[model samples]
Structures are given as C-alpha cells and as structure tokens.
Target: MYCKNCGSALDNNAAVCIHCGVPNGHGERFCSNCGAEVAPGAAVCMACGYSLSAQKVAAPGAKSKMTAGLLGIFLGAFGVHNFYLGYKGKAIAQLLITLLSCFMLSEVSAIWGLIEGIMLLSGSINTDADGNPLGD
Candidate 1:
C-alpha cells in the first residue's frame, strides 16, 4: 500500500503514514494503489488507472429515519426530532416556541413538527445536519 498524502510506501496494516503523519488514504495528492503522484481533482491515476475519487463512507451507527420521524410526530412540539437529527438551531427554536409560550403556541410548533415528520418518513428530509443519510 501507499500513503495517499505523501506517496510513501506503507504497511498494509498501518493506519497512518509514517513519513507524512497523515492517515492512510486521507489525501488525493498520491495514488494509494501505486504511490504515483496524482493531479488534483483527477478521477483516475495516470500511472495505474486507479480511481482517485473518494468513496462515500457511511458513518457507523447512523440515526434511524423511523425513530426521527416518530419523534417528530410525537414530540415535535418540543423539537425532539430535530435534536435527534443534530439540528440544534431548529430544535431549540421549536422547543422555545412551545415552552416560552406556555404551551399556548404549541399547536404551531406541533403542526410544524408534524409536517417535518411526514417529510422525513417520505424521504423529503433524508439527511441529518452532518449530511449523513438517515438510515431505515
């Protein structure tokens, strides 16, 4: 294997490059397959025809869509769903709207949350604040 950041030869089991101190497969400057320097934004390596495009790696333990949708449906007035989805601002807004108004304006937030929950269940809102796709 090779360090994509520095083109240094790497042990197959190494997690980082000894020479560059960068995580293995972390950069696009060099090809990980053959240690050849690669052009920035190039899709394939000129030396080995290896793909240079970064693959989409799903985050471990992604949040569940069903859970988020249910939270939105049941506790949306308190912004529980937005909180679970990492949308702190929206969550806080929803929470404050319901709480500060002494529950008088809760229906507004509740309706808002219901629409969002429907959107989540229908895949209209598919990703969390970190841009990770919500899992089933």
Candidate 2:
C-alpha cells in the first residue's frame, strides 16, 4: 500500500501515514500502486496504466449510502435496499418472504431489512455488489 496523501510507502495495515500523518487512501497527489506523481485531470497512471478514473478512485458505481439506507428503512420488507445494492438473490428471498407469505410473516422480512438498513447507515455494510464503496 501507499500513502495517498504523501505518496509514501505504506504497510497494508497502516491506518495513518507516518510521514504526513494523513490517513491511508486519502491523498490524490500520487499513484498508490506505483508511487508516481499523477497530474490533475489525468485518468490513469501514464507509467503503469493504473486507472485514476472515478471508478478506480471512488469504488466503481459509487452506490449512494442515503438511497440504500432509505430503501432499507421504508421498503425493506420488499428487499428494496438489497435490490438497490445488487444483491438480487437475497433481495428476491426477502421479497418472497413478504409477498409469498401474504404478509403473515412480513415482520420477519421487515426486521431483516431494518437490521441491514442500520448496518448500511452505520458503515457495517459499506460495499455494493461490485465491491464499490457506498457514497456519502
């Protein structure tokens, strides 16, 4: 790993940069993969071809945390949040739990959604189907 703030080499488990005191994966001055200086507006590392695009920098689709949280809170019984996050199988299961049971066991699905919603809001569930970090 490398310090995003200082371009300094980093231990994989490092939480902060020893040279700059900045958190890891927080800087934009250099390439984390190659430690090469990256110019503003450059989409990738000219030397190593490491993509510097939004997906690379911000975790692919950048799923919205707020949207997922709200869906989990409001339509969780229908697995709305799971669907939004691309967990299709799990989402379908939740949806069926409520729909197939004709609401008799809706509480089960609702509680499940509620817990997941809380997890999303609390950063416990922070990635989407593509392993993208949820956007704030």
Candidate 3:
C-alpha cells in the first residue's frame, strides 16, 4: 500500500500515513495501488493503470446519528430508526413483532430499539448497515 498524499509506502492496515499526515485513502497526489505520482485530477494512474476515482467502500450514506437515535427512541417499536439506518431486516422484524402480535410485544421491540438508539448516541454503534460512519 502507499500514502495517497505523499506517495510513501504504507502498511495495508494503516489508517493514516506516517510520513504525511493525510488519511490513507484521502489524497490525490499519489496512486494508492502503486505509490506512483499521479497528475492533478487524473482519473487513471499512468504508472500502474489503476483507477484513482474509485474508493473501496460499501456505499457510504452519511447518515446522521442524532436523527437515527431520536427515531429509535421515539418510534422504535415501528423500527423507524433501523429503517433510516438501512437495516431493513431488523426494521421489518421489529415492525412485524409489534404488528403481528397485536402490539402486545411492542415493548419488546421498543426496548430493543431504545437500546440500539442509546448505543448509536453513545458512538458504540458508529456505523450503519453499509459500514458507513454515522455523522454527528
């Protein structure tokens, strides 16, 4: 691996470059795959033929933690927070648990959602289903 900002060699698991302070995947001066200096705003690296624009990610959503927490706290029985966070399976499960049981089991879902909401607010659950970091 290489530091994208300075073209310095880096460990594969490094989050930031040691030589340069830039985050591992945040720079444009160097090619991430080959550590070759790339032209400014170049779409492809000429040295090793690598795509510069593409990022290794699972579809970041930039979701807000506050909104998700509030939803989980207020409408957790309906799985609104989970739905907002892109956890469709969990949301549907909570919704079904509340509806199919005729609201008798609503507290179960509510408590579950409430716990998850608290976790989110506390930064324990920092990422959404797509592994995107939640915004403050």
Off by over 4 Å in 3: 1-61
For candidate 2, give the lDDT of residue 12.
88
Give the per-residue lDDT of model 2 (tens digit) for 41-82.
455677787765544445545788788987898889999999
Q: Candidate 2: deviation at residue 69, Å?
A: 1.0
Error of 2 at 131 (Å): 0.7
Q: Considering TM-score, which of the candidate structures 1 and 2 is the better prediction for this target?
A: 2
For model 1, the superposed segments whose C-alpha errors exceed 4 Å read 1-58
Q: For each predicted model, how many residue pairs clash, with residues at least 3 apart or on different chains? A: 0, 1, 0
lDDT of 3 by residue, 15-129 (tens): 8899978887887899989999998666568999896745632244488889999899989999999999999999999999999999999999999999999988866676788
Model 2 residue 73 CA deviation (Å) reads 1.2
Q: In model 3, what is the error at residue 99, expressed in angstroms?
A: 0.3
Sort every candidate by TM-score, greatest first: 2, 1, 3
Cα lDDT, model 2, residue 31: 78
Could you give candidate 1's per-residue lDDT for residues 30-123 as a string of tens digits?
8989999988656568899875643433367878878999999999999999999999999999999999999999998899999999888866
- What is candidate 3's local distance difference test score? 0.86
Instruction: Supply the TM-score for candidate 2.
Output: 0.58
